[model samples]
Target: MLPNGKTNLIALDLGIHGDPIKALERIVQIAKSGVDDHVVARELIALSDGRAETRPVLGMFLGGAGLADSILYCRNQIYPLGLSNGLSHFLTAIAVLVSLLFGIRARFLPPSSNPVRISLIRDGELAGRFSVLIVTTLEKLLLGTRTGESQRGNMKLMAVDQSLSALLRLGWASLFRRMGKTKMQGIHLEQGDTIRIEGDHSSVILDGELFEASEGHPIVLRSTQPVPFLRLAA
Candidate 1:
């Protein structure tokens, strides 16, 4: 997608559809009861044809050191997995250790052209690339710069823009100048913001379905009013 459109979404949620008229009646009943916001939302019995920014910006899970996978994180996307997943974890540990000791980020990626912009408009483009670019009215993201923990269900659009969001390691420490949003590598989007990306032969995946972008036909993203969809707890 050029910005965030051309929909082919595949999400797994509870299959519960209720009558809108009855739903309205229940909503009014709930409003009179003055229940919690989450409770009120849960009581809502309708569906919303919502839109999401499906222009998949490389969404990677670094193996969980709180950053991607477990205590050590590959700020860069360095996944030298071994024979088995456990072995992969071991390899990850060794790689991180070696990288820190040698003061070298063992990463090599093609230079990006005119980094993608996640903004409200082309004129107000924000320069940066992110590992996790999330636009939602949910809890804060896990290991995020601001929240530092997984979302507890709140609201906001946050983006962790970077080809490699710095590691608090020896090598990265020496290159402090290269590790920050100040270099136009961060995000906090309000409503009406649009994410624009331009590249040769750009391909976008929406809800797992893929599509290609070409000249005169670009992908686009826009905001949507909150949908009255069912919220099933996991």
Candidate 2:
């Protein structure tokens, strides 16, 4: 239960749709929000089965202490009075700890890829940049084989030129339309298409498939090989 009594309301609502991606997305969103909201933080701790509690305590301790003072007064300073120096020390510690945790989580749960970049055109044109994360995976029987239904499969697909300008235009237009447009345009790459992604730390080729094709908005893609650079990787 959350401190506000919202016991996974958002996640429950998403689960009603039997969509794991949606559920996970909601979880991440909620977690990000809870970084500041105590109520939400409590909810996350509950949902994560206590896996999310460590950093908050550390945060509270650091926040109550001053960062600069802690560093300078390390020698012969009374242990308890150390917190009375300045708040900067606590803030810095919290930042470093949080960053480390995030890095570890990213390694375990690779980030998602940029939607716009992943759905690139072959003609050197670039579309707007958007991030995609799979919150949940829904199991469905297709031709007697159990397959996962992805968020893209539930939504629309939009295609645009592989140019930054084209991407911006499409992205803004979609945002204005309440993110309802999903039409795969520009270079048409069907399901099972092989493509390469170049990122800051890594470059890899992925087998992309059209998981969801919205009539007029965006096309969701699923990769046979995992790529983590976006918000949601799974």
Candidate 3:
């Protein structure tokens, strides 16, 4: 690897899943504006402001090298909700003709999300099962609900058991109408709360990494000490 020293957090929108030139085009526009990096974040963040398209930007902002003695960033970003953004994001990813075909299919062949049993283990006490468990500190968009500033660090869970079709409806609501009013059977975990997920076989995406979640084996989740993350000051 090439030798490195200072901190540089570069976010680009080039990818196979989404438009590769979107971010590059924005970068060129920013260059022509003759502005400094201080204004770059505002311009970049605006691309996703109140819009569906977004990239899962994840990292640990460890200042200095990986030395143990260096100061660490005190922030964590986690989103356990399943994949899928709003309709605008979906529409941008494909040809217009195919988009129409898939849109029709989605209504008739509405998707399904397997039921997952989540148990919150907090402060040596095991809380009962919850049908929905969503944890996030980064993304503002997902599953039709937005977390307030105060709710960022806590994990939200729902004990109200919902039918399979209801879960599907809730998910579709997120995709079609994000800002539109919808309900979430939700509650938050206290700081330092741990959790265990048990259910049929499935997979999970953590920090952009995927792992197999087999049946009969429950996955336990615990929050670690906050690591450093690069956040451009507004």
Candidate 4:
């Protein structure tokens, strides 16, 4: 049961049937409402119940964190394997930590021949640029796989442990570097930085759901707030 007197979850698939803009706006509204992280998690879980494959629930939590300092306070930070919900929180934690640690990062993936231009915008101006954005795309593409495809363009739940360990040991150090032939770019960004992707107006999958964009208009991604994601014992 949720804190909002709800026994069932709301079907709010942000990037799917719902509009990303409106969904973001709603999340912002919820953030402003001063709701507890547990409540937020429950609502998110309910919202993402049916579409486990897409993992939109994980995306919403991360996207909320990216917007502001929110949290997904869960009762079980770690649970038995039977209760594991696809390791979504753990996977998201790694992605968020990596994003925070690394600035404007993207990896070019194979199999897809097209190149996309991704820019990091700060205060309405270009701050960083990526000729190839592969990491997150590949992460979404390879979701639900038993194992991470490859270290080159794939990320797994173990990354969360890596990020946490790095944080505990290194106390905010820069560790991202350009690797491989693709020349993945990284630009250091301050808090509240916005990432804008402008390519041939192709559709993008953020977290899991697909977002459509036009060539003339760019899709803006922002994480003005850092969301605290709690990991349950599983």
Provide the TM-score for each candidate, comma-separated: 0.37, 0.20, 0.39, 0.29
Is 2 or 3 the stronger prediction by lDDT? 3
Candidate 3, 136-227: lDDT as tens digits: 33223344344333222333332322233434544665577632354544332332234455555433433323333346665555433343
Q: How accurate locally is residue 163 in candidate 4, as Cα lDDT from 0 to 100?
A: 31
| Number of the predicted model whose TM-score against the real structure is largest | 3
What digit string (tens of lDDT, one per residue) describes model 2 on residues 100-180?
A: 345433332223223333332343433332221111122211111122233332211223343334434444644455232
Question: Model 2, 41: alpha-carbon shift in Å?
Answer: 28
Estimate every model's Cα lDDT from 0 to 1.
0.33, 0.27, 0.32, 0.30
lDDT per residue for candidate 1 within 22-68, as digits (tens), equals 54455566567654542312111111111343332322111111112
In terms of TM-score, how similar is model 3 to the real structure? 0.39
Ranking of candidates on TM-score, top first:
3, 1, 4, 2
Mark the regions of model 4 whose C-alpha exceeds 4 Å error after superposition: 1-111, 122-192
Provide the global lDDT of candidate 1 against the true structure: 0.33
* Candidate 1 residue runs with Cα over 4 Å from true position: 1-114, 137-157, 163-195, 212-216, 232-234
Cα lDDT tens digits, model 4, 55-133, are 3223322221121110122112322223443363464345445554554344311111123444534334332222112
Error of 3 at 108 (Å): 12
